[model samples]
Target chain A: MLTEERHQLIRDQLAADGKVLAGELASRFGVSEDTVRRDLRELAKAGQLRRVYGGAVASAPFAAATLSQRSRHAVEEKTRLARAAVGLLSAGQSLFIDGGTTNEAIARAIPRDMELTIATNSLGVASALVDRPLVELIMLGGRYVPNLGTCVGADTLAAVAQFGADLFFLGSCGLDVARGVTAFDSAEAEVKRAMVKNSAGIAIAVTNDKLATAAPYRVAGADAIRHLVVERTAPAATLADFQSQGAQVHFA
Target chain B: MLTEERHQLIRDQLAADGKVLAGELASRFGVSEDTVRRDLRELAKAGQLRRVYGGAVASAPFAAATLSQRSRHAVEEKTRLARAAVGLLSAGQSLFIDGGTTNEAIARAIPRDMELTIATNSLGVASALVDRPLVELIMLGGRYVPNLGTCVGADTLAAVAQFGADLFFLGSCGLDVARGVTAFDSAEAEVKRAMVKNSAGIAIAVTNDKLATAAPYRVAGADAIRHLVVERTAPAATLADFQSQGAQVHFA
Candidate 1:
């Protein structure tokens, strides 16, 4: 069979059986195990599947965001916002962080020697903080969302609600002046709302472009947010308008 | 058409399209949207597929251990080991925790007010520590292993070796007088061994039933372990045997 044919067949098998063993695929395709592995590698690079030891599994349902894709959307804005957000942290304070590429950056930007308690839903954030000796990491438990590399659901929300964090670092799919913070998933939005409500202060991390966008699910309104942290060059007048309305704007 | 036939058709559509939209499936299967949603829910419950907001997607290949299934095994024994393990801890002490079911129990058992630095490979451990006011949690990064909910790779091993932790909390798939500490995955074993080599002291947490079993991969020998922390009712003679082999055996 042709290589593309083999790849297609492998994907079909993965969908049908939920996993594919290298030896089994090799024998079935009449190819060397090395060839099967190569095929799996190529498919993985294409974001079609995930290769595991001696086998391959179906990729997570939501497409895994590439590093470049994550870095591009509002890069400088996220960095400035991260700096401003980290400034709120004090020694011995507790925090709850939601999952977002921007939040991962915030985890990295946190000082290594500050005595702080951090509760988060992002695996990326948890992994980033693994070596910071002064930060206490608390990962909330719930159903694992493979695509996002985090946990979510009613259980996760309930767990977050039980702890009153001094500050909450939040991310959103879109933020409308009137509709509030919105996300693509309703369940995740509920979790975000729960986090916002449970924290003493709320910091919305966003780029200038995301300030007026709208998604399917509403988490909260702009008025509910305590801080609007944005990049230095973000529309100052637009930010001022938000500050005038209610939010305390921080231009980092 | 029969319910089984309808189910099979929906499964086939999901396999072909990667997702089955509720409206599309409803029309194709000559069923109502509610009926399709119900079918998707049932499939999700069976672990045959995942139900999303508007449709269903294929489930990931690996079977995740249920929370209750994990909670039951080694409950009492792990609690005993946790108490003994915490005794080794002090304010400002840094530690490395290996990934396993029992180590997760140890993470949960940590005192809420103890000030310490904790590095771990287990997601369960990190999540359990999220809310504690005094614990600093670091999660080591590597290739994420879904079944284990931890990262393991050469990078993870190298990162672990860079730190000299005050204590290392270790777990094993099996432990034997002849083989010492064993793990199911070779990659996990490599990381565990690296952790043991980088720590000031090593404590092995195991239940009595795993006393003499050997697994596919070896982590270390009994001589390298500083403390063998086990439950109170574990055979005293077995503890003596380990102590005779140069391990500091402690029963809690």
Candidate 2:
């Protein structure tokens, strides 16, 4: 088959299945895995799809939406993920939580009776916890980005360095096996990197829309995440990929 | 009149007139200003009235309410003061805003088109400014106090030191001529004092209830405040006292 024909077939398969495996594609087309990988590389370069560990997945359609716009999207799915993420917590654990609408949902879902020490750079996250008496909240200060509803820049980075928490709820823009964790903003990516480095373990609660996706800035490898909360409707093969990376997967 | 009768009359005057000038009281009672000062001191110690520059005024009774509760009280009065406070701003100026429902109202009242740099320790304040594109917000990081709805402790004090802004909108628990600016929380008081020291000028917006009241920790003297925004219903004597101390008084 011509290389363009193979690329077209891969795109159709990815569109239909949300992801495509290199080995399966290679065997099905009677071609080499290297050839399939090359096709994925070209597709990803063209922004057609995202490359994963052994395949590529469709990019999220609304990744460029503002924070408020994103908060209103997938409310039920994010809430399910939030409830599952809250289940992973104990009564008195200190947490390093990054800023995102999903994380804001998690903040709201935290039980009022639970005693927690949560440190965050997100105003939305902190505001959700303001009325919870048992929670000791720490806000990281910096230049506030209205679009993200979070504080970023040097002051935030310095503030985040003070605490090494037991768990970190990462704000993910995209998650892929091959490319690891990713984000849309460079400064936000830096903050997430610092958070991953400072925390004892990292937990990420994402909707299925973020699975097998890739963004511009890389945060860390998928192997670095210790816990992941996603929808039960996520692709089984994608769940297996994360499981292979040694992450404890929870289905919401 | 006997000493006890004179004291009762002074208390009555403070109640009826909202304040009692020591010199005026002495002249009315055919006594020296020293005698009137002694009477004022005794009343202040008893918490019956607050001592100001030249007299005593009625103490604000609802000083111990929680932040959320306070936000709900005097909605119209606060909005009026907030509007007046916003009028003080010019485009491109930087402001250090302290935490309070009044300051939050000021945050909300800031024009969307105005270009400004605002640094705050209040989650409510930052949340209010999150949607404004022209404002660059800086949050002071520290331990969050739900009761006050702001960050406090050592880290917040340290974060506040990094900037010297054009003006500061002080969060006042009590504003007095003699006792000066005061707050109910010691840590919050420290944060406010740091904000005052780091800014070029200090402004405060208060409802009629806060005038001449005194809380536990001293923030600064009324003389330190360069701008004062208050309800038009505030006593003329109190307004004159602040103006006499060099504060540019604006009545809402």
lDDT of 1 by residue, A1-252 (tens): 899999999999978965688898899989999999999999989978766556766664322231222322355456567878888778999888888767876876788778888878676576566556576666564544545556677546656766789888888788877777899887788788888888888888787768778999988877878888787677776777678669988777
Residue pairs in collision within model 2? none
lDDT of 1: 0.71
lDDT of 1 by residue, B107-128 (tens): 7678877888887768657655
Top TM-score hit:
2
- Can you write out model 2's per-residue Cα lDDT over A79-130, one digit (the tens) per residue? 7889999999998899998888789778878999999999999876776677
Query: What is candidate 2's CA lDDT for residue A101?
Result: 76
Q: What is the interface RMSD of each candidate, in Å?
A: 15.6, 21.5
**Docking class of predicted structure 2:** incorrect
Which prediction has the highest lDDT against the true structure? 2
Q: Compared with the real two-chain complex, what DockQ does model 1 have?
A: 0.03
Candidate 2 segments exceeding 4 Å error? A1-73, B1-73
